[model samples]
Target: MGALAVVAALAVAECSGGSTGASPSAPAPSPSTASATCPSSLAPANPPAPAGAAAGAAPQVKLVVPVDTSTSTVLKPDPAQQLQCGKVQVDTKSDVAFAAPKLANGQAKQLLMDIQVPQTPGPKPLVVYVPGGGFVQDDKQGNLPLRTYAADAGFVVASIQYRVQPDGATYADSIADVKSAIRYLRAHASDYQIDPGKVGVWGDSAGGYLVAMVGVTNGDKQYDLGENLDQSSDVQAVVDKFGASDLSKLESDYDAASQQAAAGLMTVVGKYVNGPASTQPASATPATVAAANPITHIKPTDPPFVIFHGSADTLISPSQTLMLQNALKAAGVQSTRYVVEGAGHGDLSFTGDTKSALQWTSANVAAPLLDFLNQSLKG
Candidate 1:
C-alpha cells in the first residue's frame, strides 16, 4: 500500500475494502492472424506473470476512514487543479484495427479501438477502458467523459470494441478480443506513447466482468489468443464497476421482485453461456458459467483491485460486488470496495458530463480512482 498516495474527503465512502450458433471449437491461435509482427526488443521471451504472482498475500491497506466536517474543504477543487468534466486537447486515432479472429464461417472479424493520447509527455501509463453493453452490443465510445478526463490527467486511454453476442461471439471470443487488445497496445507501445510495463484496465457492467477475467486469468495461456503472442496481456491493476462476478449465483442473490425485473438480462446471460444458469443445480453448476466467473480464477497472486457498485442497484445486486470483494479478500489479494449511496445501476452520477455532475465525480469517484492507478501503475 506504500505505492498509493492518500486522498482526503472521498464523500462519506462506506468502503469495505455469449454465444450464438455452436461455441468456438478451439482457442484462437497464439500469434493470431494480424500481419504485424512484434519487435524482438519489445516482445517478452516468456509470458510475464501478474505483478504479484510469486509474492504472498499483499499487505492489507486501510482505504477509508472516518472524516470530520472540516474535511469537506478538500472537496472543492483548487484553482490550479484540472477540471474533470470539460474537453481537453487530446490526439485521437479512431477505429484502429488491432486484431482479426476467424469467425464461424472462416471469415475474419476485425476488432477495433479508439486511442486518446494526451498531448503531454512521453511514455505515460496506459488505461484500457472497456464499456459495458450487456454483451449484446459494443460501444467503444460509451464513456467519453471519463475517458477524456483520464487522458487529460496524463494517461493514455484506449476504448475498445470487442466481439459481442450479436456477432456470434461467445465468452471465449469476447475475452480473447480484450486480451488481444492489451497485447496489441503493448506491441505498439511506442506508437501510442504507452508504458508497456505499466498497464491497467477499467470497465463497467458487462465490460467489468471482462476486465475481472483479464485480471484473474493473468499469464493464463488459455485466454491469450490471436496476435501479439510475444507480448503479455497481464495487467497491473483492475477497476471493476458493478460487473457480475458469479453467474451461477447471480439469480439467487436477487429478491423475487428484482429477479423479475432482471428477467431479460438473465435471458441474455443464458444466451451468453449457451445454457440456462438459473435452472442449473447447485451441485452441478454449468462448466461454462464456472469458467466465466471471475471469482473462480482468483488467486493470491492476482493484481490489486478497486471495485465500485451502487448500493441501490436492482438489475445486478450489490451482493455480486460483495461476493467478489470477499473472495479477493479471502484469497489475500489486495482489494478495496466502495458502495455509492443511493446510486442505481449505471447511474449517470458516476459518469455524467455536466459541469455540476463532473464536480461531484471529481470528488467522489475520480480522486480515489486516479490515486489507486498512480499507486499501482506509477509508484
Candidate 2:
C-alpha cells in the first residue's frame, strides 16, 4: 500500500468505535484498565496538597488520568469553579475534524484528541502533546504517558492529531494544523478551563519538529490558517525530543541515505516539499528550506525550549539538536539541552554517568522535565 493508504488504514483503525466531541459520563473505564494503558513512570511522585495553598509552602500535586479505551468524548465544564485539578476524566474523541487535507481526494480528517480534564474548575495552564512517526504515521493516541503526566501535573492536556506526508500535507500543513489546534483550545479556553496565555507544547521526533515550529513561529501570520485567526498560536515553552531541525537539508546530513530510507519508500522530505528534489528542487531550494527551518525563525522574544536528543542516534545526527541549541543561544532564547548518552530516537532514558543508560532518566530527566514545565508554564 502507498503512504496514504497505510495512514488511511491507521485512521480507520483509530476511529473504529471511538467517540468524539462530548464527554463520557456514567460508569467510567475501570481505573485498572486506564492505569494499565498509562506508563508507570508518568505517575506523580508527590501529590499536590489541595487546590488552595501558599506558593512557598505548596503541597506536592497528585495526578489522576482516566484512559478511554473505547471512545473520545468531551465533558461539559462546570462554570462554578476557577481551577480544577483532581479526579480527572479521560475522553478520546476520534476524528474530530480539524481541517481538510492539501491533497486531491483528501478528505478532511478528524483530529483524534484525547482531552483530559480535571473535575475541579479553574483556568489551568495548557499543554498540547504531539506524537512522532516521522511526520507520516501515528496519531494523537501515541503519547498517553506524557498526556497523563501533564494532566496530572495540573495542566489541561490535549493530545492533538495532524496530517502527515503523502496524505497531501507538507510539514507546513502539519504546523498549520498544530496552530489551529492551539487556536481551537484558546478559542474555547473557558469551555476547557484553560489559561490561554500559559500554553506549552511537547512532542518527540516528528512531533518534536512540530513543537519546535510552534515555538519558533509565534506571532507569524503565515501559519494562522482555517479558523481562530484572532487567537494566537504562540506557545510559552517547548519540549522537543530528537526532532529534525532542517528537513530540506536532511538529505545532505550524515546518515542521510538511511534517514531518507527509514522515512519511507518515497522520501518524507520530498513529500514535505511536494515532490522529489529533482522535479521540484526550487520548491525546496535553500531559501524555501530555511523558511521551514525552526532555527531560521528563532527570535529573542520566542519562548524558552527544553530539548532532548540521543547522542548516539543514528537516524538523525545529534548535531541537529546541537545546531538548534546554538541558534537559540545566539538569539538569546532560554534553552536547555539534555544530551542523552547512548540513547536513540524516542529513548526516554537519561543515564548520567552511572549504572545503565535506560535506568536513571526517571529521576534525572523526568524530575527536570516536570520542573521545567512547572517553571515555564506555572511560574
Candidate 3:
C-alpha cells in the first residue's frame, strides 16, 4: 500500500453506521461500517479453489501506466464528503479497499460505496453503482450525480470504486471487487437494512462492462475471489449505460478505423486488456479476455437488463450493446434497450426523439432508469 498509491476509504462522521432491524417507527438511515463478524453461513455455497492466490500478490508493474490526477481532482475528493436530500441523508464510506485474492501482485485496492436509506423502510432494495472511465480512470466520487439520483429514488445505492487497468489488474480482478462489494452488502444486509434478495447493479462505460459481467456470470467460481464465499453475488437487475460487453468485439472495430482513430480507441480499451487493440480478439493479452466477455456468460437464467447507449457512439460503438441485446433475446432473458438518438458514449441527455444538440440532465436518463429499477427491484 506504499508507493502503490492505494486510496484510503472514507469515514462518514456526521452519519452513524451499521444496519437496523424491523421497527414500529420509521427506520432512520445510518452509515454502514465494515462488519467484523463474517458468518460462516455467508460464504459462497461452493467456493472455487484459490486460482492465483499462491502467486505473487504484487501489482502488475507493466500495466501500471502513469495517470495524471492534476485535472482530475475529483478522483481524490474528501472521503468524508456528505450530501442530504430532504429527510433522506446520503453518506459515502469512501476508499473501502478489499484484498483481491486472485491478484498475482498482492497489491491491496479499495472500493467506495455511497449509501442512502429512506425514512420508512423495512428491508430496502439496493442498487450498486459502478462508474465509467475507460477502465483506467475515474473514481467512485465521479458517480455523485448518479448516486444522489438513485438515493433520492429510495433505492439504497452503493457506488463502488474498483481497481482499473492502470493499477495492473485485469477485468477478472475488477469483477472480483464488484462481486465482493455485493457480498459485502449481503453479508451485512441486516445491519444495512438491505433486502439481500432484491439487489441490482448499474454501471456506465467500463463500469457497465463489469456490471454486464456481474449479470451474466452469476455463479462462475473462477471470478469468485473467495471473499464472502458463503453469500451469492447474483444481481436481480442490471442498468448498463454504454458499457462494452466484449473487449474483443470493441477491439475488432479498430481494424476498419483509420490509423489515428484506432490509436485513440486503443488508448481506452488497450489498458483494460493490458495491450493494444491492433493485437486483439484472437490474441488479446490476458488469454481470458474472450471468456471475460458478458456474451460468453449469457444464459436464460440471467437477470433482466436495461441497456442505454448513444446510437452514434464512436468510442465503444452502439453495436456492442446491440450484440448483448441480441444474445439476451436468443437466451430468452428480459431486456430493454434505449438508443439515444444522436447521443454519444455516456451522454444520456437527448431530449428529442430523433436528433438535437446534446443537453445533459439526470432527469433525461433518470426517468427511464427509475422506472426500470422500480419495476425490477420493487416486488
Clashes per prediction? 2, 23, 20
Residue 97, model 3, lDDT: 39
Q: Judge candidate 1 at residue 295 and give its lDDT.
A: 90
Clash number for candidate 1: 2
TM-scores for candidates 1 onward, in order: 0.72, 0.70, 0.68
User: Local distance difference test, per candidate?
Assistant: 0.64, 0.60, 0.58
lDDT of 2 by residue, 1-379 (tens): 2112222232332223232211222222222213222344432222111111121221221112221211111122222221222245543333344444344334455454556654445788888888765555545655455566557667778877776653556778789889998998898889667899999999878788889989999999888888878899989999987787877544244333333333332244555655323344323467777777899899999999988765445445566777788889889999887776544444322111122223213445455567789999999
Cα lDDT for residue 198, candidate 1: 94
TM-score between model 2 and native? 0.70
Instruction: Give the top-scoring candidate (lDDT).
Output: 1
lDDT of 2: 0.60
Residue 96 displacement in candidate 2 (angstroms): 4.5
Report the C-alpha lDDT of model 3 over 105-223, residue by residue, as the tens digit: 45343344555554446788999888765555435544454455566667777777676654555677788888988998899888667899999999988788899999998878777
Decide which is better by lDDT, 2 or 3: 2
Model 3 residue 57 CA deviation in Å: 39
